[model samples]
Target: MTATTVRAVLFDTFGTVVDWRSGIASAFDTVAARHSSRLDSVHLADAWRRRYAPSMQRITSGDRPYTDLDTLHRENLTSVLAEFELPFETSEADVYDLVHAWHELAPWPDSVPGLHALKAQYTIGPLSNGHTALLLEMAKSAGLPWDLIIGSDLTQAYKPDPAAYLRPAAILGLAPAEVMLVAAHNDDLRAARDSGLATAFVARPLEHGSDQSIDLEAESDWDVVADDIVHLAELLHPRLAR
Candidate 1:
């Protein structure tokens, strides 16, 4: 793709830009300490996260009506607590506040600097399954430096859907090829590629929690696959002397 043609870089948020599991686990540790002395923070965090995809699939497959990420998270949390037989009691307001922990996720060490470098040359933003409010809060909390936020709420469709990849390009007044979806997951890149957008993969090997098995390497030939986001920025913007 031509330099002028590539106007924006859209990113997958959770595993791509932020370490959601670690961030959430940290938050759970803090909250659980305040809520109950007996709480097993790591177990709670893991159980809740394990429910995320299935919750989203319920909406995606029409098994359940559409709900925002916060609501879905709360539903999962309730089930997880019940399954674990945690004795702590929580109000709806408490659950709501807890679910918002997702909005405050910490960016990976290279994320802010790399995104800043790329933003100097391209319109940078997120294209994620997160809700618009959640994305905005995440940006503010983590200093993500995005030009816009495109979430599933915008298209009512999730990633791997061609519309989800192409809609952002349309909204940015560019052709499909003019946008690049930068992600850590090969499946996300594959979807972007199939939708005619350029693809960049920045490896985040520890994304899937400690015993991560998938996405250890790129499975397909992406336009670019870098060791990390810093390398990705360098590839996207070469240093040219005056």
Candidate 2:
């Protein structure tokens, strides 16, 4: 994939740009404080995220219809709550607010600036499983300067799915090869590659808060691999150097 061939970059939002674990842990702590329980916030956050993949798979396999990620998040949160057995009871409002934390997540220090760099040369926005409303709120919350959002909401199918990759190319009026998927997860990059998009892998070592067992680095020599988003931009758009 030549750098010259790429006209747009679609990103995976959660671990790729935002620190979901840290934000979710902080939210859990805040909620725990509300209920006056000394919950281990990080563990709860991990437990909640542990449900993410299987939750999506349920919908992807046609057993459940395509549901937006925000609803999936709420359902996962409710189920994780039962699994964790929160030490104290919380109201429905509290649970909704807890699920809403995804919308309030903080970006990695480089995310916005790196995007600013890339946006100079390419159409850029999320190609994540996150709902459009959720990604929009996150962009507003974190000042992400997106050209436009393209996600599972657009195709009603999550990434790793061919449609999720191809539909964005169609929407942008570009060939799949003309778009690049910038993500921290190798699996995501692999899917993008299979769908004919260029792939750039960026490391997000703390995405799972020190216990991250996977995606610690690029598994394949994708079109590009960089230490982080900023480096990715510099690598792809070397003119940014000046």
Candidate 3:
């Protein structure tokens, strides 16, 4: 598909537009502070995120009915707390607060600016595994200027599932080829492409913290490969170039 054929640009919000690792780590620190315990917040963040895919795998594999991200996160929090062996007992309220942290993630430095730039021309919004409520809260918290949010709650499917990719395109009343999936994960882009959506790869080298090793570069020749969201805007909307 040509550049002009694309009408909407949908982003993978977690690592692509927001810094989940730092945001989650900071949230964990806040929780630990409330308990007056010094926990490895960074490691806790990693552990929590490590459970992300596996939690969804159950539903994606049809082993369980579809569950929203909030419930899955709350469930994963229980497992992570057990694995961490927190010194203090966490009440349900505390668990809910921790789960809510996912909705308070900070955007990448370039995210807001780049989104504004792209918004001048194309439709922009999150097409994420996050639930609609989570994505809406995150967009508001991070100053994300999205046209709309299409979360897993709406589609009832997660990434790598063809439904997740195609459903959003249909919801927007656009053909799959008219939509572009911008992501930091090569696998996600591959899924979008296989589902007939155009793809853009935005490298987020620090997404998994300083030790991140994967998705530092485009593994395949996507429609666009950018250093960051700002670069994505420049690549897609060339008139923004100085």
Model number with the top lDDT: 3
The residue pairs that clash in candidate 2, if any, are none
**C-alpha TM-scores of all predictions:** 0.92, 0.97, 0.98
| lDDT string, candidate 3, 1-242, tens digits | 67789999999999999999898888877877898887788899899999999999999999999999999998898889888788888887778888998999999999999999999989999989998999999989999999999889899999888999999999999999999999999999999999999999999999997888899899998999999888888898799653
**What is the alpha-carbon RMSD of candidate 2 to the true structure?**
1.1
Arranged by lDDT, best first: 3, 2, 1
The global C-alpha lDDT for each of the candidates, from Candidate 1 onward, is 0.83, 0.89, 0.91
Pick out the ten consecutive residues of candidate 3 with the lowest summed lDDT. Answer: 233-242
In TM-score terms, which candidate is top? 3
Worst 10 residues of 2 by lDDT: 150-159
> Is 1 or 2 the stronger prediction by TM-score?
2
- In order, how many clashes per candidate? 0, 0, 0
TM-score: model 2 vs. ground truth: 0.97
The segments of candidate 3 whose C-alpha lies over 4 angstroms from its true place after superposition are none
| lDDT of each residue in 58-148, candidate 2, tens digit only | 8778899899888888889888888877788879878888999999999999998899999999899899898788989999999999999
